[model samples]
Target chain A: MRKLFSSRTVVTIIIAFIVIVGLITGSNWLSKRTNTPPFVQRFSNDLAGGVSRLISVPTTAIGRTANSIGNLLDTFEENQILKAKIDQFAQDKVRLQTVEEENRSLKKQLGLQATLTDFKTVSAVTISRSPTTWQSQLVINQGIKAGLKKGMPVLSGAGIIGRISEVNTTNSKVALISDTSEDANRFAITIKGNSGEINGIITGFNREKNQLIMGQVTSDNTIKAGDLVETSGLGGVIPSGLFVGKVARVTKDDYGLSKRIYIEPAADLGNITTVVVAVSEIGAK
Target chain B: MAFWQLTRIRVVYPVILFFLLFVDGAVMSGMGAFFTAFPWHVLPLATLIWLFYGVQFDVDKDMPFWIYVTATGILFDAYYTGIFGTYTVAFLIATMVMKQAKNILDERLLSGLTMFLFGILTFLVITYFAGYIIGIANVSIVTFLLFEVLPTVALNAFFAVIGYFPVWSFFNFLR
Candidate 1:
């Protein structure tokens, strides 16, 4: 006993034991002693309740303040994010407005069709971009629910934009003709005198230049620069007589059987934010 | 010189805890922007910190321990900021576990070391689970681990360091 009391380890162990025992015994005593003299018990209960209230009040106040401050900071951060998004949308709105005005002027000048013939148009917003080497696709914020069925022709004011490949509840994926390996090509023949069929693949090669390439045209066909390339209506993918692009340059092959024609795409694929998806009129043929 | 005598000794530790809670709220809210996954929460961090502090300190001496534990839980579960009650349950269980562990590692130094280890481990598990549960696809594991655990550990340690002197003095005065 003397040795145990003399050591620091023993002293610490004893202190711990006493504390544990005291806590257990005290709790047990309180539980058992609840049935006591009425006045004395009432007074003790009131004191305990008052102490509990005192402890609770400050803790609750601090907690409320902490929560409010946290909420305030969150509100400030969220407001900043919302403000940034609004600014981006505002700039986009201005560009879109300019485009809309220019499109109205072009429509009045061209007088192509009163309502672009028969194709149904659905408005879609660009939402996301896929990361890939050659297969660049975009997710648009319109889906099957928005009357955007699969294989629908997408377009900007200039001409045919792309096609809807995938559809979801609130979004759809579009595969642009410019994406490498996409063979969304169709035959085009001019409507003027000496009309001849020309087979060319349409692709968006340079985004910044807004250029689409139409190659593999037969050398026998007399084609000129600025000749309008319209859908031959033969490919079954795109509608007949829809404007694709204009012939920019033509180069004869080694054998001279076919000519590779460079065509500038009518649609500006780079800056496309909103597009009109043309829903196919089933059984309209 | 006479500050100790003028102030109520009983209220000191709780007051310090209250102040630290405020700092914790601010720093964690700022960090939440980065730490947030799909569901949007910072409870895991708060729970981990509360547990570490409970385990390392003399929690047995905490008067009306349930009150503080409940308060910590309420503060941790600010889900109106996002989804509700995700943090409250986490903090309550965490503090309870730490209180149990405190019985075993009673010494300050040993408890502190254990607290640091637990702090790191809990942070990792919570972040991993947060990502998994919330379906945050495309973020790398290394990026998640570094961002989630490292900042929290550093921040908690910073607070602990600043708090050490005051805590020590208060305990010493009480003794």
Candidate 2:
């Protein structure tokens, strides 16, 4: 027994026991205690991001080259298909001009203020993607320098894109409205001829499918297929009357009072490159 | 063969651990350049330190063991941690406890695994806690376990097979 009482043996035993106990009970406490300093955390994050950018540049360039080569290998009819799309754009532009002129003439007749000038649009490009899929977030090139703030709305050319989640000095993480965990309420949405409200929560289901599901809507809203949904301006963070999506399928719950409408959001979220950040009109309550 | 003299062999393992951590950082970063998604997870280094001493029952040489333990903590802190130096304190506490476990388990594979597993687990918990303390990680509990723990365990196991022998050999030379 005396021989077993060696100083080294005793110390090792004491240390090991404490560590096991600490790990079982004090893991959270230890984690909270050892956070990196703020400045260091920010600097390291930027450095890591910058390094990743430098590393990815060559890879992206190669991918683009491959894609262009693949496109050239296709037959001539593919080119005709593209040409038709271009012609459609030309006709759409002419029609838009005619509508604008007609709208102005009608506004004069009704003496109403023009609404198109109300929105201030600033375009931005995505810089980084979150490593994990649990958080579907993107860091855009614009930041405080571009007049971006927390909760500012980001939009795809089609409809409501997301809201600014975190703003750094030169970049900001946009929490896409499609992100499932988000509890965003008060979406400024308008349905077809009703011109009233279609309210619910926005979330993303499958990244591969690139769809946004707006659920928990009221069964009384009279939502139907192909109805255009737009932002209602109730959140005050986003402007009123911005197109959000179209009602795809509407189903009632067990209670039959609340409806779960699966919205096919207007934005093709997967392919979005350039997005507009609503820098102005933040907090315009 | 003297009990007290066994300290010479014991000191070698800790020194090897300290040096490996430095190389681990540079190597992992360098590997990341090539693979882009190379499983480069930094599990707690102290586990191996604990297991090393835990297996080597003659590690009762207090002075040498503590020094090696402290060195392990410092190396881990310096290499992978965001704020730096915090891992050193956590590691020392972990190693000290491992020294006790060494008394019961003779230097063997099973004992080593036990210590290593504990070290790795502690690292995950501590680093995440550190993240919250510093505001680097604000993820929910479920996300943390999914993103941090599961991936780390897989990476650690992969590295363990490839890394263990070389590390053991280097430490054996010192012993």
Top DockQ: which candidate number?
A: 1
lDDT of 2: 0.54
**In candidate 1 chain A, where is summed lDDT lowest over 10 consecutive residues?**
A127-136
After best superposition, candidate 1 residue B142: deviation in angstroms?
32
* TM-score computed on alpha carbons, candidate 1: 0.35
lDDT of 1 by residue, A1-285 (tens): 356365788888788656544543343234224322234333432333233233434433554465567668789778988987998899999998998788778878998443323356678655333221123345566764686655667786687767765454455656666543232232333322145656555533543233565555554767677777765544454555666678777677568776766676677554454678865443124
Clashing pairs in 1: A178-A204, A212-A265
Give every prediction's interface RMSD: 21.1, 10.4
Computed on C-alpha atoms, the DockQ of candidate 2 is 0.06
Please list the residue runs of candidate 2 whose C-alpha ends up more than 4 Å from where it truly belongs after superposition.
Answer: A1-53, A62-88, A101-117, A156-159, A183-186, A193-211, A219-222, A240-243, A268-274, A280-285, B1-175
Over B40-120, each residue of candidate 2 has an lDDT whose tens digit, in order, gives 222323245434443444444434666665655543432233223446656665554555565666666667656655656
